[model samples]
Target: MVDHRQRRDELIDVVWRLIVEDGLAGITIRRVAERSGWSSGAVRHYLPTREAILDAAAQRVAELIEERIKAVDASAPPLDALVAVLAAVLPTDEQIQRASLVWLAFVGQAASDAGLADAQGILYRDLNQLLVELLTMLAAMGFQVDGGPASAAVELQAMLDGLTVHVLLGRVDADAAQEVLRAAVNRLLTRPPEADG
Candidate 1:
């Protein structure tokens, strides 16, 4: 019996591989069929268009990051867990590197593609909400967030987004990005509350 879910995942994997090798422009129904060794009709049966392929690739990256975030040690020290959550979203490893690049490509194309733009907005909202929850938890655990959890999540999200680009562009390596993220989180967690005027 064909495991439909497994087949879909394999197709998405092929999409990411193609994106890494040739950018988003490299993706096509026929190309995916070739790469996955499936018939073009079969590929179309799963994802009817190039946009669908891009959407799936972007979604897979988000899913991978969320899975990593959920797997972080809840029992670990608060700071470590926080770092692990943020780090889970970074493109620090081979798998994440490929996935992140595909996501970035999709985001870059979103500027001209309304469907992709909508998906991008939803992705940002979901990720932002996740960060807000994490920040709220840290605050409850005795960490101080400089601008409340919502604002802190925005700041952390920006830092994470920038660090991903920097890491991918060779401006900073994975270790450096991790250090930067750690420092940023530490400041957010440990900064003394502002004095009233």
Candidate 2:
């Protein structure tokens, strides 16, 4: 009896390795089977199509990042918590760099693939909600924010997304990206909220 969940995770690991070696363009049913040492039929038994495989990979990426974010100390100081949460999303290590590559590829592919787009949407939405919660915590602790928590979260989310790309592009190394994120969160928390127009 196949431990279907375990087998699927094993195949996803192969997909991540392929993604690190080559971009998403490198993935195919045959390549996955060869990489996993499974017959193509067996690989198909789990992920039957290219779209199915990519969708699953995207989901795994989301799950991986969410797990990291969830592991941060929620009881820490609000400012520290904010930085930790945002930093968790950045690809600061080799493993996460691979996931980031896969994530970016699916982001582009998601434009034409409705299923992929939905997965991507859920990822963005969940991350955004987490940010909102952390930002709200800061506000509750009497930190001065430039806007409401929701608006501030949007800005932080965009900044984190851009930083992820820069790190992946080699334009910004991981250390510098982390420094920039920490500084940005500090500024956001200290900056005064905007008055109503």
Candidate 3:
């Protein structure tokens, strides 16, 4: 018997490549089957509808990033750790670029798709919570932040989103994007905690 889970994952991967090559509009069940080296019938057994395939592809991209975030080293300095985590979402390399393509494509879909928009809202909420946690870490490390941590978190999110868009459009390369974000983070914070305090 064919492993449905394995086949489903393969189809999702094909959709990912198709998104890179053709974007969301190019992902049909037949197209996925053609690219994934499976028959349309087999692909359908895994994904009964085009929407199902898209949802699977989006879920797969989310899972990949979540796994990367979970795998970050716990012993790094607070800012270093936060940068590492945030970089997972940025298109800073080939692998991240592919994930970003899928994510940004999903984001584009969100404008017209209520379900995707809701997912984006949930993602933004989680990102906000992460920023708050990281800002608290900065406080503990003695960084003076403007407008407090909550406001800083919102500002940082906006900055990152804009940078990611610029990077995606080739207006900025990955290194430039990273450096810009790092510089922005530094500008928004100051005065690290004293050793004696």
Q: What is the C-alpha local distance difference test score of each model?
A: 0.84, 0.84, 0.77
lDDT of 2: 0.84
Residue 148 lDDT (model 2):
83
119 in model 2: Cα distance from truth in Å? 2.5
Residue 189 in model 3: lDDT: 77
Q: Model 2, 29-102: lDDT tens per residue?
A: 99999999999999999999987888788889889898898899977766777788888888888878888888
lDDT of 1 by residue, 147-170 (tens): 999998999899998999999998
The TM-score values for the models, in the order shown, are: 0.88, 0.84, 0.80
Least accurate 10 contiguous residues by lDDT in model 1: 188-197
Task: Report the error of model 1 at residue 130, Å.
Answer: 0.9
Task: Enumerate residue pairs that collide in model 3.
Answer: 142-192, 142-193
* Pairs of residues at least 3 apart in sequence or in different chains that clash in candidate 1: none
**Scored by Cα lDDT, where does model 1 land?**
0.84
CA RMSD of each candidate after superposition = 3.8, 4.2, 2.9
